[model samples]
Target: MRVTPPFAPVTDHDLAVLAEQLGRPARGVIGIAARCVCGNPTVVATAPRLADGSPFPTFYYLTHPAATAAMSRLEATHVMAELADELAADPELQAGHLRAHHAYLADRARYGDVPEIAGISAGGMPTRVKCLHALAGHALAGGPGVNPIGDAALARGDWSPQRCACARPGPMLDAAGVAE
Candidate 1:
């Protein structure tokens, strides 16, 4: 499968903001996958392999603090179990999730083919819902219809991409989370 460019090139300023968001320098970043209303990175596209030569399976990584918190809250409420049950019971959702798994693999394949992590998509895709953060990240990055589980998580979350919940607006910020 071929994955088109729905993302922008990563820049130094983006790296700095990502460091602030992730609490570490971003690694194997392909581009900013999704952004907040104010342009802060919400999801990032990463390479299949990391700088340290580790096999990385997650393609769409969610970094927005508020969004991650929201997903965490949802997970704490046992929403992942409910989603997994739903995925098991609903045939359409099951099929869609399988396609989503394939799509995710295709997207990741565009970066590189890592033999160690091959046939594995993140967040327990095509089988179960393990991580809402990963699912929501993929949903946000690929847009509405790609991942049904991701869309469901995004729908259930309290956070909104339509609003700006970013730390700073324009340019890179300081360590204190203020615009520099």
Candidate 2:
């Protein structure tokens, strides 16, 4: 198997947790891509194609409510637009985004191929800055330098993965969305 996303094995508990985090059943998730300090899944690595056989382009999916909200806030404030301008002005940033895009594709390639999603990386990689959530997910899954836009988004966001913001799997909220 190819090394990818730190490879956190999936479990029934994980699936349940993801379902609650997503506010629905978490579909097409292959493994936990990143975790909160409390060990809850922050990001999940999804298959290029869902079980239903539909093409799913996003691989690293951010599920943490706090993190997702943070990214959304940044987007609301037009951080993506500012990042896009930076990407356009800085050659180094552009190159990093290109590399990030390739890395995303390579990581997804390890799972399985979906022709419909060929050459497509999430978060508007390689040219655009459309989604901070996607970029942040990639950054969280791959770590610092893997996705420049992701890293930048994380840096600017108020949320920090270093701290435990997870609701915790208990009466608080577990994968089943209920207390054990």
Candidate 3:
């Protein structure tokens, strides 16, 4: 099932929130692909070609700090090799991954086609599980079942979309007993 929703235009407030989360200005952000439970952006959909005219295959970029940390931890364990082994052994998984590759391409095409990366998808998809971060980002943006490898990585990881792990304060209390 292709779970990637249509892109929603980025707003200035969304960019501000992203900048705060990333500790740098957000660039080439076309839309917010996924949001935290507290409504902050968790995944951003970026243009295939950056402003400087470089080909960036990572269309669904994970931005939530907690989620990124979780993916990084998984990567540190060298889980990609294990997952790559599984991918090689499972025919169903290989088919699902190919579908995900096509889905990723379709998603990137919406932003504008960049011929340099026409057949390429992020995270070494369809043939290898190279980057947990990119796969996890795709899972977050496309939701549960779209990318099998991505979904598996998310399931194996510690972070979840169901809960809010945002560093920002929630409903701050003011002296007047009103939320700030």
Number of the predicted model whose TM-score against the real structure is largest: 1
Per-model TM-score on C-alpha atoms: 0.91, 0.91, 0.90
Q: Report the Cα RMSD per candidate.
A: 4.8, 4.6, 5.0
Q: List, residue by residue over 1-180, the lDDT tens digit for candidate 1.
A: 325345666778778889999999888999888877666788999989999999999999999999999999999999899999999999999998988899899988878899999899989987989999999998888888888999998889899988888887645435433345
Any residue pairs clashing in model 3, and if so which?
Answer: none
lDDT of 3 by residue, 1-180 (tens): 464747767767678889998999998998888877666788999889999999989999999999999989888887777889999999999998888888888888877889999899999987888888888888888877788898988888899988888888234324332335
lDDT of 3 at 94: 98
Candidate 2 backbone collisions, by pair: 16-175, 17-175
lDDT tens digits, residue span 1-180, model 2: 123654756878788989889989999989988877666789999988998999988999999999999999999999999999999999999999999899999999889889889999898987999899999999998888888889999999999988877777323334443333
